[model samples]
Target: MQFELQKALPVLERTPQVVESLLYGLPDEWIHNNEGGDTWTPFEIVAHLIHGEKTDWIPRAQVILGEGNKEFVPFDMKGHIKEGKGKTLSQLLDEFKILRKENLAQLQALGPTEEMLDLTGIHPSLGTVTLRHLLASWVVHDLTHIHQLSRVMAKQYSEAVGPWKQFMGVLGGKR
Candidate 1:
């Protein structure tokens, strides 16, 4: 479908709640374990989403809108690691909701026209891209992380599921 802010806003607005609902009050094992290696836990994913709210979405949109920065800064996906170190999961979830609300309000305030949405901006790695792609990406990024969050959480039961693990696509190694 064509990128439409009105259509996208509902998902964008509810993403934080979806995340919070899934993870708000689980035990440490459920909230903190990862798929291992350098992968993020649900806790860390919340932090990363908060980081994106503060640094990635509206900031880059401002660049596209010609508010200040002319080119997108390379996003620090790992910045959440440090930013979230001392915070609890509840704090991170609260912060994510607030920041996302603010950013969405700012976006609406921009009142971008089709011409503005069609305007191009320079991404550090992806070269030139349009505002429409950026907005669509903001919605999809929430979805991608939501999917990642679910998959990572489900994989925590990879071994416990035993014989049924093969049927669980989320746990991978599907036979």
Candidate 2:
């Protein structure tokens, strides 16, 4: 799809709400509770999402908006997790919400399409990328993680034991 800020803005704006709903009232321990395998806990997912925004999305947006170097360095995901370790879920979500808002403002005030294309960033892995493409991928990235969160939540609810499982089954396997 030809992704643009106007096209992706709604999804971007709504993502925080979706994430908020998914995380509401979830026990702190639930963040650490993996799905009986190597699957990441909800907490790790949230942390990763926030990290993606800070390290990937925001910097890329800046590059696309002609505010940063064309040859940007890649961010380390593991380092992000360690740094975010002390933060609570609410704190991380709040930071993400603020960053999202800021990104929206930058997107709204973005210059002409030509100017956007003039900008670039070396993705460390992907090499040089046009600003437009990077912004487009940011939205795609959000949708990917949203779907992942949905799947994880589904697995958690479905595998829930005892009365919770019975109740969730009654609620169409969602709770």
Candidate 3:
């Protein structure tokens, strides 16, 4: 589907709630174990989302809006490891909710126009991008992590499911 800012806000707004539903207060099995080495657990993904909320989406939009730097600084993909240290899953969830809420409010307050949506910013690596793309990505990025949370959790049951594994596509092959 074509990206529409109006079409996207609902997903963006609900992402925190959705993520919180999945991870808040879950057991270590669901919150800590990942699909494998270096893959983020559900808990870390919350921190990653919090990191993106602070550094990625709205910051990049503001840059394109001519409010700040013309180019986005490279994001630290693993920044969540340190950022999440000493924080509980519940705290990360709460932080994500607040950060996302404030960022959305700021985006609306920026009052983007049709022309503004087409205005561009330089990504540190991907090069030129539009406000529209950034907004759409923000939506999909939320969905991606939600999917990751489900997939990682499902995989926790991969061995136990046995013959039923074929019915569970989220538990994709190869562990």
Candidate 4:
């Protein structure tokens, strides 16, 4: 599918509100609640989102637009551990909101054209990615993490949910 900034910009803009509505004012215990195994807590997920806002989407778009076929830097998925340390949930959310707004403005200012969407950049892993792919992935990435945060939070009540686990997909379903 073609990359549609008109569709994507709204989703990107609303991400902070969506996250805040889901997580704001929750107790530390609930925010820090994990699903066990290697899963992340809601706090960790927001932290990771903040990290992405700082480093991922706009930086990569710049590479695709400015340096066609040049190698792009790999994003550190686990960088949140050090980057997010000593930060409260509110700080992370506020930072993400500001960063996302700035990034979106930067993207719009670029005035992307149809040809620009076909521009290529070399991913450190996937290799030879298009601008369309990068932009689409950015939108999808936000949605993926939102769903992930919901699932992680829902699973905190796994035991309390009792027999409803079969009916409650978020508790046991694959993401």
Candidate 5:
């Protein structure tokens, strides 16, 4: 378990970078793809991530830091995506970037203590998870959507006819 946690930290550290890479150079139209009427575009995903960071993640982190037994609620990603419907891709990405940086700062400030690893709140889906698990999941969530955004970008590029399309194929890997 210790070895696994150590390995996961580097992935957590890469969340911001993953987000930047995932949303970089996305087209404006692609940001508002209400095509299927049931899917989130790249812009919506960024906004949802920002909302998660601000509402779900930070409060839980504070609770884990010995503040109180505050109940951590799950974020409403669908609602956030809807609320951010008209925002530009750049605007959403910038907000997500700022929120992610703040999360990283808070995580960095934790002392190396077992108390830091305590499981405080029970996630409705994930059940009881430690601070360490929550921290790790934060990055995993970022990475998961990073891949999703890249796929959206790739599909958009594939529909285009240019050298940029060829470049997109190489850039958008599932890794």
Candidate 6:
């Protein structure tokens, strides 16, 4: 698929609202509940999303646009726990909305061209990647987390869902 910034902007811009719509005002127990094992709670997911907004997408884009082949700083996948310490879900949501808006504006300001999209950078683990790959990943990352949040919330009713569990793929299906 082509990398059209105009097309990507709306989805990127709407992610925070989509998360809020899915999660806001839900009971604390429900929002904080995890499916056990290594699963994340909805609260932790939001925190991680916020950390990505602050540290990942736009910063990597800047490196691709400016530094050419410079290797990216490896992202801290587990850093959100410290970053989100002492904050409530509502606070994290509000902060994410603000940060996402600012990042989207910065992306627009960069005005990436086709050549810019083709420019490459070195990822610590993924080897060479392009701006096009980064931008597309940003959009997909939002969607993946949205689906994760939905699945986590759905698991809250795993047992309560009764025989309908067979039809409700989210409850029993592998992620």
Q: In model 6, which residue pairs have backbone atoms overlapping below 3 Å?
A: none
lDDT of 5 by residue, 49-110 (tens): 77787787667877666655655676665767564767766777677767777776776676
lDDT of 1 by residue, 55-104 (tens): 88898888988865578989998988976999999999999989989999
User: Which wins on lDDT, candidate 1 or candidate 2?
Assistant: 1
What TM-score do all the candidates reach, one by one?
Answer: 0.94, 0.77, 0.95, 0.94, 0.72, 0.95
TM-score: model 2 vs. ground truth: 0.77
Error of 3 at 96 (Å): 0.5
lDDT by residue (1-175, candidate 3, tens digit) is 9887778889999999988877777888799899998798888898999999989998888889876568998999998988799989988988899999999999989988788999999998889989988888889899999999999898899899998887787886543
Off by over 4 Å in 6: 173-175
What would you estimate as the lDDT of candidate 2?
0.71
Per-residue lDDT of model 4, residues 1-175, tens digit only: 6669798889989998999898989999789988898888888898888888778888888988884447788889898786579999989888888888998999999988889989888899898889889999989999999999888888878888787787888976442
Model 5 segments beyond 4 Å from truth? 1-10, 34-37, 67-70, 82-86, 157-175
RMSD of each: 1.6, 4.6, 2.0, 1.9, 4.7, 1.8
Q: Enumerate residue pairs that collide in model 4.
A: none
Higher-lDDT candidate among 2 and 3? 3
